[model samples]
Target: MNRTLHRVGAMCAAHPWRTLTAWIIALVAAVVLGGAVGGTPRDDYDVPGTASQAGTELLRERFPGLSGTEARVVVHNPAGGQLDPALLDRVVDALRAVDQVGVAGPAQPSADGDTAIIDVRYTVPVTDLGADAMDQVRAATGAARDAGLQVEYAGQVPEGEPTEGGLGELVGVLVALVILIIAFGSVLAAGLPIVAALVGLGIGSSGILLLAAVTQVSTTSPSAAAMVGLGVGIDYALLLVTRHVEGLRAGLAPQAAAARATATAGRSVLVAGATVLLSLLGLILSGLAAYRTYGFATAIVVATAVAAAVTLVPALCAVCGRRIVRRGRLDVTEPQRPPLTARWAARVGRRPAVWAVLALAVLLLLGAPALTMRTWPQDAGSQPTENTVRRAYDLIAAEFGPGAYAPLVVAVDLAKVPQDSVPALQDRIAAVPGVATVSEPLLSPDATAAVLTVQLEFSPQDERSGELVDQLRAETLPAGAEITGVTAVFVDIADLLAERLWLVVGVVVGLSLLLLTVVFRSILVPVKAALVNLLSVAAAYGVLTMVFQWGWGGQLLGVDHPVPVSTWVPLLLFAVLFGLSMDYEVFLLSRIREEWLATGDPFQSVVRGLAATARTITAAALIMVVVFAGFMTNADIVTKMIGVGLATAVALDATIVRMVLVPASMMLFGRANWWLPGWLDRLLPHLGRRGSAELDDPADAAPATEETASLEPAASR
Candidate 1:
């Protein structure tokens, strides 16, 4: 694999313009092809096989007009008097003027006589409509307020807030620019990673857009791809570029340095990317379309990044190798010296147990909050105060009740029950523990089904609301009643995910362990890696729960109030975090493993491996943190949560897992760290050649004495 990668890199270096031109052509093709093939992203929250989904399907088949998106205009007589008949007509007239909307019902007056609701059905699905269509609706509705009525609109209102909500990529790039400039002290060298990331992301995102034609890719998926792609993309390119610089210092020619760098670091990047994509692919085990699409989209972007890091980056490096030198003609004239990281590793190795225990304690403390973590789907109530959704929610809560905004639909199969028994069943349903009120049941055309709207006292995402759903579902009601509605659907979603959460975790953990075992060719090494990754991921979850759920410093992340973690967040976070956390684990251990093999001494290998890779791991992790953290600027709370969660995980993984737990654990294991059962060794395929090559040990590599470490030449001439 190393030789193959080196050959490809060498070819690209030899024909830099050809490589760059190929990438440019690919980028343009992606953009043009994506626009031509792709459709709008789907954000459906329906969970198949759930009662709510069943009810929705029944409704769509039976009541097409009622099932589509409806805009509800709630207007009140500010004078506390009867509404003028002319005023209602004017509002209806305004709604009728809109191209996408047709009146679903005449004005339905409330018991107070001051408040009324007018329903208008949209011609197209709400998800398909753009901001312009919504703007027209808003304008038409806003005119009713001019007639001295307090008008508020609810239901689907142009959610097209640009799927690329957070400009996190720009901020991430800026942060990377600073970190790279500091790390390399060369502006040209610092920019290469960013250039590669943007190019890769641009093409990858376009590809996701193209995917919308075949599958329901959520609008957020592209932004998610960008977020993951940028952080890892920059780090991947940085790894190769850094290696290239070292190659130049080793007295290799410009083309050979680029080729060598690609051969070495490019191999690691490929492994890291494969692991990430594999982990992401674990989302398919969820059996949810959204998860599947999100995972697949992100994997595509990561693949593109890896491709660029191995090919385009090498070409760029070759094109500018001589200019990369600050001093004339790169040369390592003086003997090299061990960096601060090497010294730190040596010091930590002296008392590995203490550092390990301390790191473990800290991780456990942070992860404790995860034990109490809860999940829910955010609704209009969770929106910011300035948002239209929030305003409509508040108005409904004030006029009717919070539950009115998210009424539970109790769909009963009348075919299984007698007609005369309906009244008695309705009474029993109304008497259910959490039922605040029950609307008059609407019978189907054949009277084979009935839909009853049950309003509760609590909001959709409220803990009490979830309890109410459980209470109703548990009830042995007649007519084979099934609970369905916005709230009920979310409850079902949470229930479904919770039921399978352990299963998904098992799959991801199993795959990661297997992959690590294959890559490192050791049983214990992979086990240790999985255990530490679990700790880091848990710690990240705990901190996010404290901040977002507990509302500790939640405002700093743009969320003004506390929120339960979104129903899908845990599963998605686990898949992503497990893969990402493994990146640092792989980065550090692969180097250490290389050292261990070279020196045949576990203790020195641990010290030297930590010393050699700490700076690189830290720099990579820092770039990721900045990129993920920048996503907090997005308006969507869910996106903000994802950003904060990922950032926190990377930070913990790099410092605790890489710096402390890893070295300490390896120290305790001694030579056992490389143990593979004789039978298992034969069972595992020898994925040879592309194996790790980071070595400075005299035994297996160039003798990296303190005097010559800084000036060490590329191994094996």
Candidate 2:
């Protein structure tokens, strides 16, 4: 692996323009082709094997019109005056005349007569709707707006102009650039990673657009993909750049430094990237189309990042040459006592247990809220307050009730039941405790099936709504009746995720454990790493629960009230966070193992390894945290949850887990940290031998003299 990476790096460095031109061409082609042919992402809430899915499929097959998109045109008289009945009729007629609107129900006035809602059903599904769908709706409602009524569209209406969500990513990159300039003290050095990351992210985002063209991709996929891609892209390049700088300070030529850095840090990058991809595979087990798309979308960006890290970054490094190294007035020429991190490591080493206990206490305390965590799928109600859909939701919730925003659809097969009993069934359903109103059944064209729209007394995100779904399924609904629609689908999704969350966690953790054990040839290290990573993930979940669920500090993130954590967050967080945490682990542990093999002193190895890798890990982790946190500015609540969750996990993992727990635990365990049972060692492939040889190369080693040591931080050594 080392030799292969070294050769690849050398080739890129030797012919810099060729490598760079290839990436440029790829990026341009991806952007242009994707824009011309790529598909728009649309939410498909169909979860196979769930009752809701079955009912939705039945609707498509039988009552096709009802299965298509539906929206509500909400008109409110904010002045508390009654709407003109003549104007309301004109509004209904305008909606009916709009293109693709199959049905526009009569305006239903509120009890107070201050607001009215007209239900509009489109002939086409959401995916089939044209780009001007929302524009047409807006145009149709203009008359109502002109008459002094507040007009808002809700319930399956197309989203308006895309949010300025990319701004968050831009800010994250700018911040990372500043940090890099300060750390490397060279503008060129600072710019390399940023450039590579941008190119990679551009390509990856275009790839997502293309992917959306072929299959269902969630609206949330792009934001999630960008968050992960930007962080790792810069992080991977930063690792190589740091290593290349170390080689330069040791008197190696630019080409040699790039090759050596590629061989060493490049290998760790591959391991880290592979682990992340592998962990994403666990999402396939989620049995949800949205999650699978999210996983694949994230994988594309990560792959591109890794490719740019190894090829584009090295080419840029070679082109820059000695200029990449910090020199002139900024250079330190004399001994500064041992690096601050090394000194701190030594201090912790002297009393390992105390540090470990303190770290654990912090993690455990942060994680306590997870015990009471609740999750529900977010709806338009969670949208930013300024959004039209949210405005519609609030108006309806205020006048009619929150439940009016999300009505459930019941699909029933008339062939499986007596036609005369349909009215009796509706009566029973309406009599159910939580039932607010049940519409009369509308039969299919052939009269083989019927559809009923049921409105509950509680909002979609409320726990009572989900409970009613279960009760209707198990107690009230007939054998052939299945509950579905957006609200029911969300309820089923919550239940599905609850059942499979642990399974995905187990798969990700088990696979990662096996991979780490094989890579490091250590039993205890993999086990310890998994445990600490889990702690960090749990702490992140607790924080998410607090902010989003318990409403602690919710207003700061733009949420007006508490909401259940998005149902898929815990599962996705576990898969992504566990793998990301391993990035720093691999970088740190690999160096420690190299030192251990060379000197056979566990204590010194831990200290040197932590000292050598701490700064890089800190910088990389901070970049990741900021990148993730920046997504809070996104208009999507689910995206905000993911961003905050990822940011919190990375922060805790880097500081509490990596800095305190890992070092202290290694020190306390001593030789056990490297102990692998003989049988297991024999069973595992010898993956580290060549990498170990590469690290041990005298030519690649850091300067041994005190003066050089002082000039360079332990990271360079």
Candidate 3:
């Protein structure tokens, strides 16, 4: 792997412009081809084998209109009077005339007579609606607005607006650039990684767009993919660039330095990328089409990032050559003092048990909240107050009861249950403990199926709403009746994820253990890494629970009140964080293992490895945390949940696990940290990096320790 990467890096570096041109060509081709043939991302909420899914499928076959999208035009007379009936008729006529609309209802008026709801149904599913669906709805309601009526929209039709992001992502990139400059103290070095990351991101983003052409990619997938891609892309490039700088300081020629850096750091990059992709494979095991699309989209971006780190970064480094090095530092001949990180490592190593115990305590405390974590699918009620959909949700909750905002649809197969028994079924459902009201059954045109809308006493976001759904499925409804709607579908999705969450975690953890063991040639190290990463992930989940569920600081992130954590967050976070946290682990452990091979003293190896890679790891982690946190600015609660969860996990992993626990634990374990059973070692293929041989000079090595028991006292060092 090292030799092959070395040759590729050298070739690219030796012909810099050619390499740049090739990347540019690839980017352009991807964009042009994607624009011509790429598919758009559409959310696939279908969860097979679930009752909600079955009901939805049944409706699509027998009563297609009810299965499609729906919208509610909420109108209110702010002047404290009943609305004009003629004006209401005009509004209904306007909506019914809109393209794609299957039906516009007789407006349902509030008891106070001040507010009314016009329910509109589209002839197609939400995903099938065109880009102008919302615009068309808005245009139809303009006349009502013009006549001094307060109007708002809610439900699936209004939910399709493209979420506002991009700005936060752009801000994150700019911040990353600044951090890189400060870390490297060279503008050229700082710019190289950014450039490489951008090139790769271009291709990755284009690829995601193209992917939409073939599969059902969720609307959220692109943003999620970009967030992961950008952070990892910059981090991967940073790793390679840092190593190239080390090569230059060691007096290697520009092309040789680039080649050697690629041979070593590039190998870690590959392994890290593979781990991320492998972790994403667990998402495929989730058995949800939406999650599978998310996994594929994110994997594509990560793959491109790895490619650019190995190919484009080295070429750019070679092109810049010695200029990447700070001028005065290159010619240093005096004995260099230990950096602050090395001093810290030595201190921790001196009292391994103390530091390890303290770090574990802190992590456990932070993770405790996860024990009470609750999850539900986000809905319009969770939206910020400033949004029209949120206003619609609030208005409906205020005037017509909160339950009316998300009424459950009970689909009945008329063939199994006679039409004469339909009235009895409705009365049976309405008698259930939580049922608020039940609408008269509406039969399909063919009279083969019928649907009854059931309102609950509690709002759709309430836990009782979900419990009620469970009650209806288990006891209340007849055999021919299946409950499905926005609320019911969400409940079903949550249940599906709960069942599959363990499957995903097991796959990711088990596969990651295997991969890391092979890469580091150590069983304990991989096991330790997994354990620590789980702590970080749990801590993140705990934080999310506090902020979003407990409403500890929900207002700060545009969350007006406490709400359940998004259903998909825990599963997604586990898959993503396990891989991402392992990125730092791989870089740190790879360096430590390289030093162990060179010095054959585990104590010094830990100290020297900490010193060598600490700064790079810190910078990379900061970039990732900042990038992930930036997404908190988005209005979408699900997006905010993901951003906060990822940022928290990365930050905790970098500081608690990497800085304190890992070194202390390594010191406690001593030589056992790298030990592998002879049989297992023989069974594993040689996949570890070239290690110490990649360095051009022994002068680059950290100062040797005299005692192998632990680092010398900070004073003596």
Over 4 Å off in model 1, which ranges?
Answer: 70-85, 93-103, 107-136, 139-142, 145-153, 156-164, 167-169, 328-337, 689-717
- Per-candidate Cα lDDT values, in order, are 0.78, 0.86, 0.87
Provide TM-scores for the models: 0.91, 0.95, 0.95
Evaluate model 2: give its lDDT.
0.86
Model 3, runs deviating above 4 Å: 333-336, 694-717
Off by over 4 Å in 2: 97-100, 159-162, 329-336, 688-692, 695-717
Cα distance off (Å), candidate 1, residue 580: 0.8
lDDT of candidate 1 over 444-493, digit per residue (tens)? 77677777888898877789998888877787455367777678888888
Residue 415, model 2: lDDT of: 82
